[model samples]
Target: MLQINDLTFDAWGRRFFDHASVSVPPGAKVGLVGRNGVGKSTLFKLILGELPAGDGEIGYPKQARLASVDQEHPATPVPLLDTVLAADVERDRLLAALETAEPEQMGEIYARLSEIGADRAPSRAAEILSGLGFRQDDLARPMAEFSGGWRMRVALAAALFAEPDILLLDEPTNYLDLEGALWLESRLKKYPHTAVVISHDREILNNSCDHILHLIDGKLTLYPGGYDAFERQREEKAKVQEATRAKVEAQRAHLQSFVDRFRAKASKATQAQSRLKMLARLPPVSAVAIEHTTPFVLPSPDRPLAPPLVRLEGVTTGYDGVPILKGMNLRLDLDDRIGLLGVNGAGKSTFAKLVAGALPAMTGHLARSARLKVGWFHQHQIEALDPDDTPLDIIRREMPEASEAARRSRLAQYGLGAAKVETRVENLSGGERARLLLNLVAAEAPHLLILDEPTNHLDIDSRRALLDALNDYQGAVILITHDRSLMELVADRLWLAADGTIKPFEGDMDDYARFVVERAKQAGKAPTQIRAAEPDPPPKPAPARAKVPTGPARRRAEAAEAALARASQALADIDRALTDPGVFAENPAKAADLGRRREAAQAALEAAELEWLEAVEAYEAMKG
Candidate 1:
């Protein structure tokens, strides 16, 4: 569906893409992955024609729609649902035409609208928004009511709702919670048309995409299958390349030896000349380049803390007198690795603050071991860094008692090299800044760490490095991140922030994912009711009359409708089981099994719904 041929682009005294060529097959979901500052976004800009390539071309079918969420949706008075529905230009055009089109044009217009499923646009838009973390009531609220992060999700929702021929998403999970990310992953897997996503989240790349597009050294290589498959294939290819290079080097040496020995003898002069030509004709092989990422340095506490380093009893805390999290009773041991799960605004951050000692309980007892020390790293810290401040300046302040040499050495240990130490924070890459803060926060060897959305800036390799550091560190952890792979690998226990309280989540990530998907479906189930809040559009004149549906078409429609109803009921039952806290708390294994069943039921319902839509359309066509 898309092709890039010998594409060369240059900017800022560097070549971004040099003779890079690749073809993306139709209907393929491809993950575009590379290291930071490696021009992934630049390539997107080139594809979108936002940046001019120095040579070659990016080609796709003419008139094919391409959509991307380049930035947050503008803050406007338009309701979120209408803002998303307006993304479908063709549907909007047809709807507008209904008011002024000649009576004779009405039939064709109505047919086209039916063909494009225009009647379902509002609900479809609502479904996308819900998957991206919008509440049921949020759909009817004005866009201006949302924060920038929420607006960013709205932009993503609009792109997905538009269902362009080619969809481009850049780090879509960055703005999302784990719930939203899981939903998006499921949604992208079923996207009908082609999609190219730029993501560092390994789980999304492995689960959502069919192909991995690697951009490295100004070249593009498309590997069939997911991120894990790409790594294996690349490793094999590198091994083969190294073996071939060795073989070629041996042949070259032999040819050169023959030429050197015989070039001095007249009898073998002619043969030597032939060997010389052969030696010169031999192809030179370049050694395979290995990619390396600086490992994160997270110091473990020098001494182990006693069990139950932190204990809370009926803890209630929030801004001012208003409580955001209530009746929070939890214990954190020195060795506990707690995965914090919740949608945004579900009191995850507030709980983190309580644990970090940044916020005190308003009405309940909270206890921590006398010698307990805590290190907290959060997403806001990166944003809160002074742009004009240099790493050197920050390090100097952080280590006022240490020698200058020792401070510089510490920054270097944090992956900030000599060249970057004096550079302003604004000039540093997001990964660099993240690495600096992550290391600095843990440098004192605290007994407990509270990390909130810690992997937002790190690439896949860096995230892996962070995971390695976390695994090796001997400290309690309360981790909150959208990166599922890291969370699954690092956390041995789970805590959920929900219903205005913090409680133990007995099930694993799989169960939680199912619960999230089902909850999103429930949130968007009444899209028509939500859309009713909008001002009604002008009345449309009816199209030409048609014959009634035949028996076969009617029968098919009725059967499909019945199947859809059955599937929906089955899924609803599963959703109830997944949502009940008691199911998980009582029998964890049974809860996990129910999660798998829920997934199957969800797929069945979607299939039945699609079949019903097709059957209804057929019935409508027969009537016309």
Candidate 2:
């Protein structure tokens, strides 16, 4: 368990937290939520003891362990498995101990050896490495060969292998594909230790966390539920506050009206003075500013396109001599909401660029439907914006035909007000630039939209807005985003660009994730299967003394015994069902029903078996 008391953090004269207090109990799974640049990461660092707190106490158990995967992964040139294995110092020591133990000493160290063999051996290392998407052959490769994204995975694997008591993850899912993200989600759910994660992916947080903590305006507020529940409650509270403010303001105005009218009359002067004093004592009502809502309207094409909005045939793309996409063939259909998935630097972006006509495809035929308008938003779109130009100016330049009034209206939709729109692009924050870029893309209304990492710098709300807009659009879209929640929400199909080929997946993102994990598990197992240590023995007969005296007595006893046996069999079935992930995946409704049935069956089986054993014992005592 960990606790923070009276924590305060300040940066450049701006206070992020003032006397904030928070506690994370053992085995607690909590999410740290806030707007962009609100010091979520800073608070995490403060807890981590990496930075000195301005004022407060951070307390944890003496033996408590902590580990984290930083937002910016450090550069490393090591094989992925080796990097992960480096975290488990104890595992290495145990392995060494087991290897060097003498034959005479082995018996005395068997208990220690068993502990290591069960949980800390090379098998565990291998299992975790494979679970994280690393192949057996890749384990021995040097870490220097992997890209930034793969390097980040190495760091993640290290943190996981550390098996600390508390995990502080900052955007762990940022670079993960749907498969990797889902595997992480599964692991976190069953993880024995507590975790406090700061993430922009809504689905990951919602699926993995049991509680939500919001840090806003130097205060900490805990919500006793997941992201969806927290959002609903926050919205309701805001509405109530607005209503209360309105009512208070109306009463204050009524009191002021009485004073204004009666001040002229001498006899009413005293009463008016009393009312004025009362009005002055009333608390001032701060006006609740309405958030500017941007209405994103994608322009409808005059004509709809047929199949194959974009196509790539025999494409070979890569830097230098390395080919990422080799003789690749891909076709994007009209009105298809396609999700491009693969590991980092796996030609996803290259394919996107090839389709957008931003890069040349070597020895390939690139084609697009005639009259199809394409609007492309790359991952580095912020760099594309002019630092000197204000958002208003950019919008005007992009939409020259639109009236000045309409241009401002479009900007307001993305939370850019009239005053802020005039601010220079350089002065705007990363999240602001992200919103502006999305707004610019929405203004074009192209029939085919190709976006690469569109949600990179967006906050939770802005990501939702962009996702909603894309969902409503009736055009062909090829989107590449690391936000798994956004992909699941908007994508109708998936295209996995891996190992020089693009494979089309004809289901939801969940199905694709399941497929990948199952495949990885199968790939990790050896071809040979070890036989069981021993086979089950045949059933035994009942004792002769326990035989019933007559027909009715025998029938009742047989019925009871048969019912007990059936219950025992049912318990065994339930145990087997729990091991099969497919049982939960293929039949959710059946799975839910089986859970309760399993508990009931188990209890009944236990009671019946106990009674049967007791009966056998009593019979043996009487015979003796």
Best by lDDT: 1
Candidate 2 vs. true structure, TM-score: 0.70
Query: Looking at model 1, how many pairs of residues clash?
Result: 0
Candidate 2: list runs displaced more than 4 Å. 71-78, 93-110, 116-121, 239-308, 311-333, 359-366, 382-428, 441-443, 523-624
State the displacement of the C-alpha of residue 480, model 1, in Å, after optimal TM-score superposition. Answer: 0.5
Clashes of 2: 8
Query: For residues 1-624, what per-residue lDDT tens digits would candidate 1 score against the true structure?
Result: 999999999999998998999999999999999999999999999999999777998999998999999999999999888999999999999999999999999999999999999987877887787778776778789999999999999999989888899999999999999989999999999999999999999999999999999999999999999999999999999999999999999999998999888899999999999988998888888899888888888888999877789999998999989999999888888878889998899899988888888998998899899998899999889999999999999999899999999988888888888899999999999999999999989989999999999999999999999988887787888999999999888887778887788887766687778777776666565786763342221122223422122445655787799899999999998888788899888999999999899889989999999999999999888756
Residue clash pairs of candidate 1 = none
Per residue, candidate 2 scores C-alpha lDDT tens digits across 13-123 of 799889998877789888898888889989888888898888888899988888888843455666555566667776656556778888887675666657655344444
Error of 2 at 404 (Å): 11
